[model samples]
Target chain A: MTPEELAEFRRRQKSRNWVLGGLLVFFAVLFYAITIVRMGD
Target chain B: MTTAAPITKQALPTDWRDFYALTKPRVMSLVIFTGLCGLLAAPGSINPVLGFTAILCIALGAGGAGALNQWLESDLDAGMKRTQKRPIPAGRMDPTNARDFGIALSVLSVCLMGIAIGWLAASILLVSILYYAIIYTMWLKPRTPQNIVIGGAAGAFPPMIGWVAVTGDITLMPVLLFAIIFMWTPPHFWALALFIKSDYAKVGIPMMPVVRGQASTRRQIMVYSVLLVPIAAAPWFIGGTGAIYGIISIALSLAFLALSVPVATRISEDGDAMKPEKRLFAFSILYLFALFAALVVDRVAAYQGFAL
Candidate 1:
């Protein structure tokens, strides 16, 4: 592949990683909130 | 303009979907369901968050074991038609990657379970993973015809683990739940084996029908099916469950036995149809789902102060 295609591939991969990382953080926060609510009851 | 060079195509990149498939999500669903039923049926209540954590640990542990199984059995899986397209066997993922992913998930789930719930549940989860990955996948599967008989215990542990997560103890009820699944596995697996005997033979996996003749395998399936009826009813007899579960268990077990009768009795020649075996295989899945659903329902009814 050309250098341009290689650069594009890396860009796309980084974006995918960011999305997945964000989703993980979202779930971690959600779970923590739920736990706090249950513990407070 | 300069002439463009011809571009070569490369293999598609492995995505999260391939990793998900390695976990055998379909199988994990049943494991989660049974584990949740065990949690729900236990005597006392747990915090919802902890309850969810126990079930999540069960799922992750089951997934880890599944990934490890696929990693170890990639060669045999490639040989079998049913499992040939799995991520490892299909060249979608590296075997080492699958193994590492499995181990990571297994360790993470156990640690989280210990921290969030109790160590007993985490320990049982750890054992279930090792039992499936090492004992069943590595040892019994290639060596013995009775692999499913003993290996079924790995699948049976989830509910007991869930119960322990709640009570932090093992009791007769959880053991009875474990026994029901343990007794049910042979008939369920053997029926599938009877129909797909060629796959096991091709892979050199010593499944019952491959190691023993079909006649013997069928007889054993019937024997287990017969035994499962009484074993399934034990929870009700012991006052762990109510009559609703008892009645459903009897009906389901009888249906399972009736389905097994033709498979056991009839002699199918080479090139003969395997309708009975196929039916039993299909019904066996339904039988377990229905039986466990009834258990949950019975518990819910009891919780609502209805005598059943």
Candidate 2:
């Protein structure tokens, strides 16, 4: 990869990683909420 | 000079937005709205947390189905102006990744729904996913002009699943909700199809306008539009919803049919814009949103001892 291509790739990778991390955290919270609701019912 | 050819078919790495695009978020919003309406309008109630989970599952399943549809129809999408900018067709993402992403979301949504809500809702969600991804996308869409008529059932499932999420079983009201959408879909989709007939023809998808000619397609749109009015009014007729929902649905359905008048009668000249079809298409979205919102409002009124 050229310098520009390499830089673009790095930017894309960083964004994808951050999004994936955010999604995982959201899912964890969701599951916890689901568990509490189920237990209460 | 010897130089290595680039191995990547994609011009750049796929962004998260590309993946989101595969979900067809605009359509997902409708699914989410209708599903929430069904949940809220049901006779009983649910915890807000559980209710949100059901809607989230419906949205995810819908997104999964949209992704799989794009993955399979990437070639067809590439041929059309409306869909050419999609992730796979635009070469922003790989088809394999899109397919796998769809499967993951599909599995996760169904499993979460079953564990979190109830198995009945989850099973319906599973069926809806399959109905869209495999039955509609893989089979009906390319094969017949009647594809939208049958495949529209896939979109109709969300509200019924939402109803079942609270009720935990099937009933006439949910079935009526499914039927209202099923009958409403042809006219709604055909209006859009009438305007974008060339896109279907270029891709050889056998849309009604391309197969039956524009006049026939318009007539069919009128027929479905007439049929939709009665079906839309049925929930009120059956005493499922109050006069509020009934009154709004009838008014909306009549307006929907009225917009079809010019579309049914007019012939398109070379330079003329298809304004009637476009207007009807725009109204169809609003009509559904308004109809479902009325249903929820009516339910609330009934719960509060005010609705007639």
Candidate 3:
């Protein structure tokens, strides 16, 4: 494979990782929010 | 190394992930969260184990409705970029399979809820699933612009169902919760429609913006936004919530109105200045979270004798 193809693949992989990371952060925050409300219950 | 030949297949592949996707987990999360708030707000106590089962059933019912919606709209979904990657449209699941799966879940969830919770909560869950899957998805969506307005009732039922789960009776507080969600839906959805207007138009879905135009939709959003303030504060006024919730409701309402007013006033010629619509859309999620969080906090604070 050409170096250009390798570079493009790496970039796509990085973008996917960022998307997954953002989703994880969102879920973590949501869980924390639920915990805070549940604290009193 | 030799390049492998592409495999040809007649039918789409399926997996657990695809089945999960059919349920629309993202939408169900919000439904479950709001229902939990309702359960927490009610006056009576429920068995913890039973309550958990009730919530799980509610989530499954919501998921069932969503799967049925996707199955019905699979064709239209393929035509729209936003929904083109959904399981059905992406060739990961067959429409008939999704239809059967949704119906099965719908029955299972309602039956389990009836046995574990009460018939009242279970019946409401059954109606909610039916309302969304059949009334909204099959009947209203393709036919009219007012679909979401009437269809919002399905989403509004969770709190009532939750309240019933705890108390086994309907009351003003749960109805107030229902009304809050009912009134909030249009503005919340219209804000999203503003950004995705073209998609609805392309599919002939007759969303408010597509039918009445962007300007009219913006006006309607502002109207609903203003209306939501009083409705949100009703619980506080009626003593279901306390002063802290009252203050939070007012503040959040103001923030929502502040965001929506600009969208209402912006001229279409000023292209994209209606970005406030999108801002309001994002804030709407936070607005709901804050209002419900305030309710839980006030209840806790009062229980602790921190208030008059």
Candidate 4:
């Protein structure tokens, strides 16, 4: 592959990773919130 | 431009960890959580060692059932994109080895529970395994969409087993806990099905979405979600729990209902359009964990003689 194609592949992979990372972060915060509420104060 | 070649050789994972993945760890977390609730809520005291042993046995039994489930569904797993990477399907572990491992663990766990705890607990554990491995995985999964609804009994048994381990008797409290988990399974599963409908379709499984279509599936999810709120709150209404638990129960149920109503009521031409099911799927995990945690915490308050 050319340098340009290699760079494009990396960029696409990074974007996919970012999307998954964002989802994990979102669910983690939601779980933590529920734990606090259930823990009471 | 160079095109990618399809690889013919599959590298198998030789590590023991690959075998462990056969048991669904995520589902077992809920089982352990509810089992702990059962142990905490019983009227009498249990030796801490014995109590821990019972919980361990329950986890092992649950895991064993999961392993057997994977063994039976290996072909189906291979077809589904989401599950195609499981150990058996991925060719990391042999299917027969998984079957043997599951059977061995199932017997060992049941025997240990019986000797260390009580026969009642052991019996419940055995039945739970049978219900999942034979009744649900083998019978119901390939047959109908109502599989989860009826087969959810296997998931619901942990608390009752825990209760029996401690009190050595069945009562309304444990049954109510069973009911809570039982009712929670449908919406929880259906929400997941909505997102992964293609996987189920590919494998020829009649999940709610694959068999009944999205609108009917959404309606069923809402119906279960609405039904679950009252069932979850039953402990407080019947005086099994206190004010604090009652408040949290109602609050969690309300949030769950709020999440489900939009999915059920949404109007769209595309079958896979609604994102609310995904939202509900994520929140449902939190909802069950909080509901049970509230029960556990409320019990602690009561024991300490505090008006919670």
Overall lDDT per candidate, in order of appearance: 0.87, 0.91, 0.82, 0.83
Please compute DockQ, using alpha carbons, for every candidate against the native two-chain complex.
0.27, 0.85, 0.04, 0.02
Worst 10 residues of 3 chain B by lDDT: B1-10
Regions more than 4 Å wrong, model 3 = A1-41, B1-13, B269-274
- DockQ of candidate 2 is 0.85
- lDDT tens digits, residue span B1-308, model 3: 01111222112235456778889998888899888888877776776766777788889899889989998888888878899888777775667889998998899789878866779999999999999988998999888888898899899999889889999888899999999989988999989988888888887898998898888988988999899999999999998888888888889998999999988876465346556777889998888878877877877788888753
Among all windows of 10 consecutive residues in model 4 chain B, the one with the lowest summed lDDT is B1-10
Candidate that would win on TM-score: 2
* Whole-structure CA lDDT of model 1: 0.87
Model 2 agreement with the true structure over B181-289: per-residue lDDT tens digits? 9988998999999888888999899999999888898898899899999899999999999999999999999998999888888878655688898999999999999
lDDT of 4 at B301: 87
DockQ ranking, best first = 2, 1, 3, 4
lDDT of 1 by residue, A1-41 (tens): 68876776576567658767985896598569656855676
* Residue pairs of candidate 3 with colliding backbone atoms: none
**Candidate closer to the true structure by DockQ (higher is better), 3 or 4:** 3
Candidate 3 local distance difference test against the native? 0.82
lDDT of 3 by residue, A1-41 (tens): 46775665566557656766985696466446545545655
**Which tens-of-lDDT digit does each residue in B190-291 have in candidate 4?**
888888888888878889888989889889989998898889889888898888788999999999999999989874465665578788999999998889
Query: In candidate 1, what are the lDDT values of residues B126-235, reduced to their tens digit?
Result: 99999999999999989999999999999999889988988998889999999999999999999888878998898789998878898899899889999999999999
| Descending-TM-score candidate ranking | 2, 1, 3, 4
